[model samples]
Target: MNATTQDIEQLGINTVRVLSADAVQKANSGHPGTPMGIAPIGHVLWAHTMNYNPKNPEWPNRDRFILSAGHACMLQYSYLYLTGYDISLDDIKNFRQLHSKAAGHPEYGLVDGVDVTTGPLGQGFANGVGFAIAQKHLAARYNKAGFNLFDYKIYAICSDGDIMEGVTAEAASLAGHLRLGNMIYFYDDNHISIEGDTSLAFDEDVAKRFEAYGWHVQTVADGNDLKALTEAVKNAKEETERPSLIKVRTHIGFGSPNKVDKASAHGSPLGADEVKLVKKNFGFDPEQSFVVPDEVLNYYRGKGDEGVRLEQKWNELYQSYKEKYPELWTEYDLERTGKLPDGWKDKLPVFDPAEGKVATRKASGKVLNAIADSLPGLIGGSADLAPSTDTNLDKYTSFTKDDRSGRNFHFGIREHAMGAALNGIALTKGLIPYGATFLIFSEYMRPPIRLAAIMKVRPIFIYTHDSIGLGEDGTTHQPVEQLISLRSIPNLMVIRPADANETAQAWRVAIEHKDGPVAIVLTRQSIPVIDQSKFAKAIELEKGAYILSDSEKEPDIILIGTGSEVALLIDAQARLKEESIAARVISMPSWELFEKQDAAYKEKVFPKAMKKRLAVEAGSVLGWHKYVTDEGDTIGMTTFGESAPAEDLYKEFGFTTDNVVSRAKALINR
Candidate 1:
């Protein structure tokens, strides 16, 4: 590089540093240290290394960048502004303000060029792994020998907190095992954490740990050495069999006078005096904030133009490939646009009530295999519980290191990593991903599930073993409160289906609902299918709650239930009619979906005249009170389940026709 070019690059890097500090200082609450220290890293990746078009941020083959340490979002915002993305200088000035694009942490849809939300530490790292997986799968499936249609790299800047997180460890292990060569991560090894130096708790050699995980690891002694960082990245790209990690040692507060290498700099801003001193140290105007020299702006915009040209070249190559392989190109286009093939729903199986009883989990497996041939974008796996959760697509081979074209995945006992990886795949545009585990273990993956809800992405979650019905596993495996907990999260639709038909409808809801995440809760034990001929159609499951059977006139009591308990409610209703009493049976499958219905529709399902109501379920009854009135009663488990046969457990827990009839009769008398 020439002397003038080198001077301009340095000026641009310093501009990012000062602008980040100014934003945090003005906000009065933000993390500014890592951004100040890692500005050169961003400058190298965005301006010199990565191929990304700011003019079209959604370019399919462009390299993806994620800031796993999202507290330093000012660094990303400043780079996006400088590189001519949609972010403006005014947006930078409004950091952390209400309704501003510049949130305290990087949010995916709120800001341009941010690949995923990354506030809770290690989720971004796992998300990058998911991105690499999608890239490899697409490349293997679509890229012919002459047509390299999908060859994109995934890059992320992680920190000490990110590395310390166990979720990153799990995701790193999986990435190394899969031999994802397209992933490159930089560890900002600044040694200082919020508490103090990392020695207080974290002292392990992370590079060695990654080396044990089958990754190519390199270390740069100084973070500011741009030449070394660039060379390391090049070497990583050359190693086409393993994921790479470049550990760059850096100072926490690089140019700040008083707060350098101190814990105070990790989150809190360097005060006004120190900010001015830092600018003076960098030879910038001490009085100026958010200043961008004309030369630096022009230099970065030139790099942006280069990105546009690169994308245009790819587009030209794609056009040629389209001509050579017309049908394949059309399929690829559909995948990218998220448009399901016509008649895809025709493949979904509907169960008949006359057929023998079937577990909801087993019914789910049938639905998955039935639709797998039609929906090419559907891909996922269980956390080493495919057989138990009944989530495997038997028609496809398992996704392994040697074969990336398979539709099935073996996430291998990593629930947290699997959740975050699903988020990554959902963000990758072309694919719809799902992950499965026991409903009780959802607690382990709640962070990513909540993130998916917050980002409004569509990642289906198959959580089988819905309640205390999983026999012999006892209290530890039985989920008493999982349903209520999952239902409590806003924008997350939790559907506990009644039988085989409702299970099929639940899968339909999961696939068709694109607004946010959906959790289909299923049962391990067999439950009889409701006869659609005698009752309402199973398609009514979309309305969330519906009256299955009612008396000729206004019912004396209402018996509401979900999942397996609905079968018991049906039996109880029949018995009440034999005794000259009238009762109504309501199938309340999903509270979130039902709440979305209009007030008149809700009133139609639960009439105001029927004040006497009874709710029956094998789980906690925390939220059932909303449907059941003050005079109503709930027959739910008040204690943990015991290790016994499923039938005995149901009887012991009062999940039976007798219990439902008694509860309904008592409510009617009251």
Candidate 2:
């Protein structure tokens, strides 16, 4: 017996809904309404619009899909299962259970088809835009005559809450500006939210608003009409100058007799009676729970076969391209594997201590340019402060979706999207992404940074203008608490280099430490490079901290500082020596790295015998407690910054060498 296309689609859609509802009901928890309401959309996209092989979810050219409204994870899980991925029915049954592959939300490495871990409302929406941006860039960079190697779409399903987020608006605006035609979004206009109809708070014309953002907007009056969804997506694919948003009107709980179209259906599980009634409405046995018809299972199982064939075809095509263009194939393969080309680090500049004072920010640019030569996969841009941040790689062209040959990106003022996009590129496997902005504005990039850390993706963040030394830009631009705040976040390595040489080492750590996210916090003002010949090599930065100055006997006082303030501490140590005060200076670039050091190394750096410890930083003293005991004094800011030159600001804020010396003497006497 043969089945018509309509029969196949209906069976697939109902299967997804039943599986999702059953999974939620079995767990006695979860948002089933969204999966049920959006099953047809998922069905049309996964089975029809998307070019993917569940057997090879990591196919570089496979279209990407993000369930932006990730609270309804059952939708993605059902698709992963039916499409012949590694996910099994038992995985669905164990939804939200500890250690289950089917987590409450989609996590990248945990689930087979999950592109990114996205449960934080609007993050998925923004991350989807980033994925689309990566696709656009890759396509432009590698595609050639008869070698459209990177033509793939990025699709996302967003709910009312996802659209209501501020990041969504920002990301959507950027998507439009970049004209990511391959990016498509389906908005589930189901009316009911967790608090009843979105009418209670959100009633704006979403399609009209998207139009204002330069997106090609469309509306399908009936979301269940798979034909209409297919047509709308077809039109969206043909649009080359804009991203597309399709407002899909859907029922909250389609076919559920008691729960359909109600707010109660949005979050909670329907009762047994309602579940039975819903099954009856779908022409199923009322008493049977989690019952998937043989025909439905057989139909979904066939997807595995279809996916294998698709990947086989792609492999053949890749083989043909390889034979015709061996060099391009080699480059593409190397990039796809995410391995840096040889000698990338050799290009990193080594600063000479003989060259007076140099700001770490300037050194950062030099380091980036050096690494950029070796790391072809490295792509980045700054948030309108590239000149000040010194993050631009010299002579490298800027990457526009229109022209993909450029390695650098220009993110304008969208630090939030820049961070999210960097994650997207990093998720692409073969790309190393970094972004830049002032240290103070890291707050804007914090969410994606946290996600990057959680996902364990190495996306470097070059944050300059680190602390009160930012000077005349004043308190608003100065990052007083930002250092400690970044330090507080788990899995995030915050590195504040003391000088130009340490800046190079910090870059090394950021690139080499692939387990998690790393932020290279640099300074706006110049700092004296410690003479490695006089003391230990800058390579000691890997230990997190090393003594730059020491005495024959146990020091009377110890001075600890990071970034630019380390220079001030060195000067203070000289003054103390003049006064016959024995003081040691320690340059601690990263507290997180230091804490990871062996106990013996830590003790050696800051000896337990030296009870008189003092930390002199130009910012808030929150992070100094561990280094400086409660009995010791911390000479640092307790408040916001003022408008003044960096030198005067240091003097006025009592961060000068004289103040450090005075504080150290006072702490020693106490």
lDDT of each: 0.91, 0.84
Candidate 2 — which residues are off by over 4 angstroms?
A: 1-5
Task: Provide backbone clash counts, one per model.
Answer: 0, 0
Q: Candidate 1 — which pairs collide? A: none
* Residue-level lDDT tens digits of model 2 in 1-670: 2457578669778877777777777777888888899999998887778878887889888889888899889999988888778988888889888899988889988978888988887888889876877777777766778878888888999999999988888889888877778889999989988989899999899999999999999999998998899999999999978999999999987878878899888788876778777787777787776666676767776765677787788788889989998977887798787665677678778899888989999998988887886776777888888899887778788777566667777787888878888888788866778889999999998899999988988889989999888888888999888888899988899899888988988987787787788899998888788776765544678878888878656789889988888888888888998989988888898888999999899899888878789987777889788888776778888999898899888888898888888888888787
Q: What range of 10 consecutive residues in model 2 has the weakest lDDT sum? A: 530-539
